[model samples]
Target: MSIKPENINLNKIFIKYLNEKQYSKLQLHYEKLGKTEKQLPAIIFYYACAITLNPSSNIKNLKHAHNLFEMLYVNNRHDLQLLCNMIELSFRTQEFKVVLPYVEEAYKINQSDERLLLGLSKIHLYLANLKESIKYYKILFKINPKSKINRDEFLTSLNYASGITQEYYLSECKNYLKLLETNKDLEDYNFNFKNLKNNKIKIGFLSSDFKTHPVSFFLKGLLLNFNKDKFEISLISNLHKSHYDNITDELKLLTKNWININSLSDSEATNLLRSFELDILIDLCGFFRGNRFQVISNRAAKIQACWLGYNNTTGIKNMDYLIADHNLIKKEEEKLYSEKVLFLPKIWNAMTPSNILPEIQKNNSIFTYASFNNFHKISDDTIDVWSKILNNSNSQIILKNPMPSSIVGEELKLNLLKKFIARGVEKKKILFINRKKDFQDHLGLYNNVDVALDTFPYPGVTTTFDAVLMGVPVLTMKGHNLNSRCGESININLQMQNFIAENKDDYFNKALSLQKEKNILQNFGKNLREKVLKSSLFDTKDFTKSFEKIIQKIISK
Candidate 1:
């Protein structure tokens, strides 16, 4: 082929440089050409794009390359692919906040793309605006009802925000279960391939939260105990390397194989897993919509199961099993789930860094009553119950949540005060602190609290653990669903049942009575910390054994 004078002759040179992964050299080539060639805009743009696609490129080059694309892409309407590429780069670099404006702009330009909705929903959920988060999520859900968004975890998250009674929550689950049962599309999700190996079991664990996430807290012990020699462990992760903590590093060392299928298409993810000869695909993500749940509907693994990370039974028919412990799945409650329940020894083993020892409780003039649950956990009923505790006792209720940046701490405080004032509780008794940071420092900051309080309906498991780890006693009300029952489990294990309440009045009475009895609170705090140190909750070794036995049973089939 003859190169015309205006053609720039950049095609072969750019491709050769990209083929060698020489991004900097390609940039030099683009810069050297300047505006001399008519095709310079396209050539330079593609070369910068090639640099951004390189996995080895750091955030600096990705940003610079993206900026270069922006300069070349003069027509804003024709820049969707480049914008999406930039969004992907920003997401990979842990630049979630930076991606928000781009996503919003993209939605403004083209709101119908499923990929854009997916990206938007994920970011909004991260920001903790559940209502606004759900609005975009539902858009994707409507498109792929059997795909990702309408899964069990998303429904449970919505129910949690609804703040209804335990009966209502159960009723919601039962009603949703009906939809899964009758939906012909969900019924079409069966993957009973004859090629399923009897001897070898392929275990695929999928999740976007493998770091210092709430999901990680419970998964640590299980990941450590999963025997690689007996079963092939394949991890499909959307979480980027920057999200890694010490526990995540431990998971990398433990897993037999790890696949970064974060951005793969549904067919691509399914095909990738099938190529691995997967016998069992475990949806650790449940229905949370982090990574490739649409792949789950395809049944990439022969015997699919779900456990740990999400609390509810995934209503997907292709999901054959829902892994839970005896505590979480009673025979009576089995009807509530679509998938057959595989009961483990305990609900799920939680593993925390051993260094987070409980501090000795010291006397303070003002009794510090605090709960570090997310702001969403603070529903109308939860605030009402909390107000009763503060009203009955002449003490301040200190609330810590990562809400102020989304809204503001003072605004949340004002909202809570309004709730309390409506219930005739004094406004001065409520305190609110809202900020966001890495979990280690965030959990460590709870040492300033005296007695930790657990929210009802949608109670906290990880937050409760974080509070207990700081040697603060948690007062809890055990309700119907697993959400409300976490505090009871922790209290039972810690042998601090005095803090367990049966009703709203009882919860208030206990909080009030405990604050009055300082000596009793002190004695309980010391005893509780000692009990926790001796309990299986903190005993990684014992938890690991239980996890191993369960995996053995599953793979032995």
Candidate 2:
């Protein structure tokens, strides 16, 4: 190979340096080529990129990189490379708002640009503006119906929406299936079902959240206590390697077959799964992130079902059954889902009981309410009732979430605080807690909480259970659909009907009323942990039996 003058793209050389980890070489080249007007932009862009991409990048260097990108972005408004650098670096320093105007301007310049729309939609979602986020995703889908990423983001956004009726939601789901009909669906696949009453039934669970997540807690009891002799198990984990934790190790200890499909493509993974000869393949991710619905669309096993992780219908008809308990799904509402609703006997979920005491000993006199759910689930309607609860009671509410550390996390808290401020609650009346804690420490913090205030339209499932496990009863408003009614189902299983609120006013009223019965509530909390263990909600053995019976019946068919 001969080096030819004018044959090389300087930009390509810079990228090569980055890809090869030639940081010193890149810096040397930039210094040597310093004063050329044509090479300056490329040099600055790549230099800033290197800083941001470096693992040891600190706050000072990150800010300098952010500034360099901002300068380049100002000169080259239409340069997507520069714009992307600006977008990424700004978020690193928590100055995400700095790039908003540029992003929106770029979108206006080219509304059909997929990257711009993606960045915009993600920005809106992070800002707690789901409506705007959904709107952009819908636009992106309309532009490129064949793009799976676009469709995935669009459908995930729809998961947070509450359609006026179940029919309206089902129609939306049907339309998604209709769109995917054009893709290569494994329609020719057939299942060879044998009489599995004598042999062990092989069940493969697909999920990305088998690690430290809400899904893991809900899935714990089942995986740990399933009739392993009768039902052979395998786990397909779809999460990035960095996300694997102690919980992932725990899940692996339960099953002999652990498939790491994190690096496999959809087709590769599907082909590998088909070779497993699975009798029943249940998708735990549902429509949430890392769902293998596309693989399910191929019918990988004899019987396919979806449960846990997500509450509502996945809208993908390939999922033959949607697992639910009687309390979780009403008989009349079965028609709302595309899949047949498989009703469990008592509860659809059961978690491992914590060994540590559920409640931390709180000596504070101020009454406290808290929700350990994610911040995005807190809608305006949710804040409406919560704010009223704060205004009427002589107490403060503690809101905990998985936010970034130090000042960066504090900024997100302010955004949430402003929402409550608009609804007449002062900042001081609400306290924010960081979610970085040991599992035992996390459970103990529930003791300081007087009542766990569940969010509406999309109530907390695992968090609701977490509260009960910690001797704290969650106050949740009951609603019609599955997403809104999860708390209802969990509470019903525990026979805690008084904890359920019927409507908005009822929710606020119940919150205030519960505050008045502080002593009674605390005494009840002391025994609630014991009650939760005995109830069907935490009874792993009984729940697993019900689960196995359903799986056995399906395979036998």
Candidate 3:
């Protein structure tokens, strides 16, 4: 591992430029070295710095960087730092396919590098290699037991793996929670509520997605319909300043108190929340990004509960309850959650309808099945089942691409096409569509679909609402856990029990059965909008009253 004199001189210049933050000079230094002789290490270092400085560099620059790295790599320079830096750049640019080999090579060079191991784990997860992802994650955890980021990511990957038993999921989640609890001390706050004398109950909602998000879509109706005389609502928003939207404007008009806490530290946030003296603090985000679990873990309010953003348990001891309907969480599954289950009467979420309507289906000769869920949810099992449905009937499947603009997105699409082709499905039959920017256009795409197919182990929540609202029937297979049963809950609330499948055979049979009953489907599609409009799913006023009653009961106790 002795360094060459040329390499030593190049490293000295590189370190000097990096310390001085002279990125352009670093590139100039490489150009200078190139004139004298081809300095491979210097060239690779130059590209790495360029990519690091400008992550949004165009494809031409990225291709040049990749070429430089490959040239040195093939020549056996095998610099561990250079390999890791290139892998990180690829990840930053969302070029995940470019990262795999670099990570593998880095692992071979130094198996002890935590950064390389983490990147390898993430790369496998992105490629949908769940077992490999888990293996690398376990190795990383063993190497660094105190890394919060690694622990959280490991729990998330484990949660998404198909066919994981509920017992195993709960055990892993609990272990992760224990790690979090041990690493961070909980904050304590004392408050006096003795001054209460027939005043409105103060309710606070905390979330990062207070605008243009699934939580906002369901939450707006309830906010608009709240009985102002009985409740004073406060929105503790974690939304970044750039993400403000018209929906945020509407929310502001509905509530008098709107506090932006995105810039606040956990201690500062908790102090502000305690100042408001909120009777009930509702955590709309559970385990999702931008979650202030630190504040929640500190007991920011008299009563705190989790809902909407995540289906799984928060595993925080301070979180009092999990808001769900009986249909979503069965009585037998209560032990799986750390929080006490608070069952809503009918639907747990209230829907805010889109003004745009789906165009009516003209011809119903052949069936078109669709799913707009994220690409990660389409596991091997889901593909296998879906392929069977497509193979058995005169059907075509439409899947909305999760990230159509990225290289990783393109790779995922190709992988999916290969899977379908292996299962005897024509490439043309499986249509991968880019997501529309306009919300109305997104809804209209469902018009082209006959019956929407729900993903397994993790079902669609907002997408299901959007599909059915647009007169598209969704067929779902119920699962053993709360995450899997979201579709079933929606179907049950719509009073469409026949659309719920008990098993794989049942799911296929139900889909096949729908293909034959064109008249029934046509009629169902025709009347769906009206049916949903009348159901508890869309009855926000009544839903608000019921929700208010629950809040009042909790406060009284």
Off by over 4 Å in 2: 1-24, 31-39, 52-63, 90-94, 162-165, 185-198, 358-360, 402-411, 521-523
RMSD, every candidate, angstroms: 8.1, 3.8, 3.3
lDDT of 3 by residue, 1-557 (tens): 88688788878778787777777777766666554235655646564576567535676666566656656665664566656666665654556666586678668877878888888887777766677888888888788876777565666666567878878877777766666566344344343444554488999999998887788888898898988989999999999989898988888888979999999987788878877888889999777678888788777887899888778777788789888888888898899888998888987888867666656553444578899987777877888889898888888988995344653456666766887799888787898889887888888787778889998878888888888887888899888877888999999999899899999889888888888874745576668978987888788888888888888888888
lDDT of each prediction vs. the true structure? 0.66, 0.78, 0.78
C-alpha lDDT of residue 218 in model 2: 70
**lDDT by residue (tens digit), candidate 2, 314-411:** 67766888888888778888888888989889877887777665343655578889998888778778888889888887889888874436323444
Model 3, residue 356: distance off in Å is 3.7
TM-scores for candidates 1 onward, in order:
0.68, 0.90, 0.89
Report how far off residue 421 is in candidate 3 (Å): 2.6
